[model samples]
Target: MKKLLLFVCTLCWLLPPAQAQTGTYKGIGTIVFEAGAPLSLIKGTSESANGLINLETGKFSFDVPITSFQFLNSLMQERFNDKYMKSSRYHKATFVGRIIDKGPVSAKGEAKVTAAGILTIHGVARKRTIEGTLVQKGNNWQLITAFPVELSDHHIQAPRLSSGYGASTMNVSLRMPLSPTDPDPQQIVAVKKFGFR
Candidate 1:
């Protein structure tokens, strides 16, 4: 029995590493916003966005801390967090969705995909479908999407203190970079069998 166990252990060690599996992957990125009237451009960006994606299931989720958003004017930033966004009550904005890729996403190419999911902001959740491009360069994946979000839909009240800040729709852009999470046994098996990164 001991000899048999030794043989099995040796066989396992001799096997190649398993292929990459499709599972939960952690990533960090940014969410940017450009709003105000057509003539007026109000832009702010936040680098505290983090996300996760499952390659096999196409499931994805993203979150951005509201306080991370930065503006050129510190006063505007303060008001945006305390007065307009009310970040004290709602700390983060999040999106949970899946990528609709027509075919398998290549590990080294680019694909145009649409993500449909529920987005929650200011304590309000709404259904949203956003189209974006996914590019895989080396071991990293980048996702970029731009869409218009209506403040009224999320029940975000416009501040009367500044007309420059009020807008019917806010143009939002997302740029996220993701790395693979720890692979499972099955993924390891695949990696060993097929040598997938």
Candidate 2:
């Protein structure tokens, strides 16, 4: 009896935690920055953003490659990668946080949501809480949010020569249409159409 009980306890311990609901979506994400002063506003977009979510635990994560952002001007793109963002040094920016849902998040209607987590950019991590909207349409989930980012918050410094060029704060926004973890044929076709591999 004692041996059986020990074996059962060990088996239970090794089992994974209960995930009542889990889903994933592969889609594109974009970022646009509007400078305040003598600088030209820049808008960059990426079709390489990916997102993961756990509805049961209210956990979520997103990742975007630094090199994926494409600027309107080729020279600006080059400078952004080499000088400002330093893509070689810091390859990717990521956010890992949890959703703040007071009640169960509806899989059918739109819900106002907030997420609190650490955002890592240029190798600097800062705690941030962002508000957004979560909407479920058919078999898809869309997360949309827009917020301002301060350059000083992430230790991003502009060159002294161009000190007054770019804005001190940049407005950032994201919209991701996520599909199921195990996508069906229709979902796979949709993912391909979005230009994601």
What CA root-mean-square deviation does each model show from the true structure? Answer: 4.3, 9.8
**How many clashes does the backbone of model 2 have?**
0
Q: Identify the leading candidate in terms of lDDT.
A: 1
The most accurate candidate by TM-score is 1
Candidate 2 lDDT score at position 2: 100
Stretches of model 1 off by over 4 angstroms after superposition: 1-18, 37-39, 103-108, 159-165, 186-197
lDDT of 2 by residue, 13-127 (tens): 5644221113444455555554554455656777777788655456788889989988787987898789888999999989899876433355456767789998998899999
Against the hidden reference, what TM-scores do the models get? Answer: 0.79, 0.72
lDDT value, residue 169 of candidate 1: 74
Please give the TM-score that candidate 2 achieves against the real structure.
0.72
TM-score of 1: 0.79
- Across residues 120-157, which tens digit of lDDT does each residue of candidate 1 receive? 99999999888887677666678788999898998887
